[model samples]
Target: MSFLTLLDYASVLVFAASGAMVASRAQLDIVGFAFIACLTAVGGGTVRDLLLDRHPVFWVADPMPIVLAALMAVLVFFTAHLVESRLRWVVWLDSFALAIAVPAGTGAAIELGHGPVIVVLMGMATGAFGGLMRDVVCNEVPLVLKQGEPYVSCAMIGAMSAITLVWMELPLNIALLVCAAVTWASRASALLWGWSLPVYKSRPPRQ
Candidate 1:
């Protein structure tokens, strides 16, 4: 397989690991865990494909991602005890997954002949929406939409930067590296510094 294809598979596995982390935390049964993990790993990609009018979606075409995600779910389920107290580990894993996925998603949009805005939006969606879905399904606030942190904004910036690099005719590998770095650094900074968008607050009652 080509190097890009290998990277795509790596992104899949990383995203699957993040999903499995969520499933384990939710204390789901084996089948439920696999289902949630697979859905969380591929849900965003599937949505992007449908939006871009790309048929067969990605995991559907390969089937390997699903199988790998299921395997990851099983492994994580059995190994949950080891990391049960390490919530930061889960956050970092998810951040890594998002970083890997951003470039892959951008490449997919470029392959589909999407314009820069659409391509960046699609990439950000692919990197973030699955986690949003997982959080919602788990009855928790969706991380991307929550205040007091930089989340989807990081994905958006990374994807848009990648699209800009592509428009500037940069090499694909270099563009991807830049984008992934943007994602990872943004997330890490948010975690370390508590960076977040300002939230609107209603004023006190007027006289």
Candidate 2:
């Protein structure tokens, strides 16, 4: 398979894993796992396609992605028992998904004529939002929403850097590699070192 195709498949698997992890946490059924997996795998791309006026969206154009996501969800659902730790699985799977998705989303947005600013936003959303939705649906605060890590911010930086490199005529492969590396590093650092952006809360009225 071509590199792009490989990236797509990797994204699907990772996203499916993210969703399935959340479903397991929620104690959801198999069907619920599949639903979350499919949404997490394709939701961002679906939104991107719609915004870009790209017809048929991605999963609609190929049934294979959905099938793969569902199958993977099933595997995760069944294997959840054998796994000794849930948090480890969720974090690693989410990290993997973010690494694949930021580049893919940025590339797609650039291809669709979006500028650097928009591409970065799209990339960040693509990397983080589906899982955010899954968390919200499960009645938990989304990771990206917390003041704990630089998740979406990392995605934005990587996407913008990639888009800038592309604008300067860099090859797609090189851009993808560089951006993916930076994104992964930033996110992993946040997770491992407890790095976070500063929160600037307004002081309460003098009491």
Candidate 3:
């Protein structure tokens, strides 16, 4: 069990839980919960793998991630109503998933000898795409598309931070850990304190 594989599994589990919460909010059936959960778990990595031409998508190759996702879906389906705010749970879980999955994507790109740009792009894709898909399917606003939030930026910066650490000749494992920490911290700040980039304000035409 390589560390990267473990990252994938962790992200899949967390993202699946988040997806199931969204399904619960939508009042979807158990099957719908599983469907949304599995989609949110693997959609991003599936995109990353396909774009990178990595033979055999991660979930397709091992299927443990899918199984894990389905199990998480079942758990969340039964317990979601216990939460007073499923939306908050979904956000926090998705943030954790973003942190884990971004590092996994960066590591994959780095291992493949891809340049920094590809690393950053893959990281963002892997961290955000699943949630985007889940939200779109569930008719919720996509977090990545939310105004001013640093969602995609968090992934990008996290990947670049990993690259910087690697360039300093640090251990790859340490770099990945830093990546996860940076990504999660960025997201947490946004969620907790409303940290965000400046958005252009629309104004009436001046005379």
By lDDT, the candidates rank as: 3, 2, 1
lDDT of 2 by residue, 78-191 (tens): 998898888678877888788888887787777777777888887887788767877778776787787746778888888877987898899987898788888888888888
- Candidate 1 lDDT score at position 123: 80
TM, every model? 0.92, 0.92, 0.97
Please report the TM-score between candidate 3 and the true structure. 0.97
Best by TM-score: 3
Model 1 weakest 10-residue run by lDDT: 1-10
Superposition error at 176 for model 2 (Å): 1.3
Give the per-residue lDDT of model 1 (tens digit) for 1-207. 654456567766776777777777787898987887887788778888888878888777889888988898888888877874645666888788888878878878887788888888888988887787877887767777777688888898899888888889998778888998998999888988888888876676852
Q: Of the pair 1 and 3, which is ahead by lDDT?
A: 3
Q: Model 2 off-target regions past 4 Å?
A: 204-207
lDDT by residue for model 3 over 27-142, one digit each (tens)?
99999999999999999999999999998898878899999999999999888878998888988999999999999999999999998899889999999899999999999999
lDDT of 1 at 205: 89
